[model samples]
Target: MKAAPAAQQELLRLQALDTRLAQLAHRLNALPQTAPLAELATRDDAVRRSRAEAVGVLEDAKTELGRIESDVRIVEARIARDGERLTQTSSLKDVQALEGELVSLKRRLSDLEDQELVVMEKVEGAEGAVAAIDDERAAIAVAQQSLEAERDEASAGIATEREQTDRDRAVVAATIPADLLAFYEQRRVRGGGVGAALLRQRTCGGCTITLTGSDLEAVRRAAPDDVVQCPECDRILVRTDESGI
Candidate 1:
């Protein structure tokens, strides 16, 4: 293949742009925020689960407290009815039985009140736990949002750079002959994004292999306009003054 020396040099510039573009793409995919965002997601899920459990416990405590209060009300009503009977009764035995029932009702009320207190304490503790979890979740949310913003900013910068690189690549590619450009594109796809390299110090820069004897002679004998290919990697070898023919 034959291309002007200027065009050959353009290939080097194209390769550099392509390499930078690849690096930018890699950086975009491996954004620093990705790992932390994933970790936050896991933590958020755990916190939510904990909050839900606390809510369940609190609700149960409330229900138990309500039942205890209801029972206490019933016992108080019974004591009031028995006390009225004692005031109305003429028989001594009936009065004694009513007094004994009143005492029992008082004991039952005390027990229900004690249970209510315990349940109320549990409810309070559960509420506190939920509040704490909510606070933690809110903090995590703020961190996640900040990280997302940073990731977006980094992505926007990379996108702007890529747009400029694309424009430069288009201009450089257009200056080369159509056939040569097409050949370079084909090699770039096949050679893992590298199509050309400098032949410096008798070494194939593409594959870092030193050419000797006949291989060296062939490259040295080639015209300046001739497109030499690396014998090891088959990439176009763009020769320059430092080529060490």
Candidate 2:
């Protein structure tokens, strides 16, 4: 004997629910761990900060180096002028003072050159730090790409499954009587998309409310193919083999 349209509609709703549940479960299972993405983001931020710091250091060192080099050049020029003045000076005191000034300028130039060397070394160290940070960022990018690919693959499978389920739903819906479909849709809108439910153990599957003995007897007396609604939630109730009642 063919089941009533109400029972068929309930079966469709169950299938739809199961499909939705399965899709959700698949997505939940496929999701990446939050910790790994968070950790990667942290590393990326740190690398960016380090690179910025390195650039600042390098710029400062270069500026200092330039300043020191300029000072050295100025001292050398002053020494040359003093040397020419000493050779031309006939006065004894002026010659001695000029010689002292030249010696001081030479010593200052040497100190400036040493400072420039120190600045250059710091600049090199800063550049190396920048390079290291860049490499780390590159590695992080590769890992991110791999993770994205995995997520896409997992999502694709779920999409395919959902498409197949939708096709099956369409097929099942086409066989349903229009009047029954309209009734189911109306009830479903009010009952959270569950218009019909199975009768399990004398309880309403829609509300899980147990039926009284009299109500149970009444349901039992109904035609086998008749569509009946639950007294509580008004959802069409279908009897199944698993119905404890």
Q: What are the per-residue Cα lDDT tens digits for candidate 2 across 24-98?
A: 666756477444666788989988998898889888888888888888888888999999999999999999999
TM-score between candidate 2 and the true structure: 0.64
What is the lDDT, from 0 to 100, of the residue 17 in candidate 1? 92
Runs of candidate 2 exceeding 4 Å displacement: 1-11, 14-18, 21-29, 32-38, 84-94, 163-197, 201-245
TM-scores for the candidates = 0.69, 0.64
**Count of clashes, each model:** 0, 1
* Model 2 CA RMSD to the hidden true structure, in angstroms: 5.4
Q: Please provide, for model 1 over 57-176, each residue's C-alpha lDDT reduced to its tens digit, 9 standing for 90 to 100.
A: 889888888888889889989988998999999999998999899899889889888888888899899889889999999999999999999999989999999999999988988898
Residue 179 displacement in candidate 2 (angstroms): 13
Q: What is the Å distance of residue 53 in model 1 from its true position?
A: 3.3
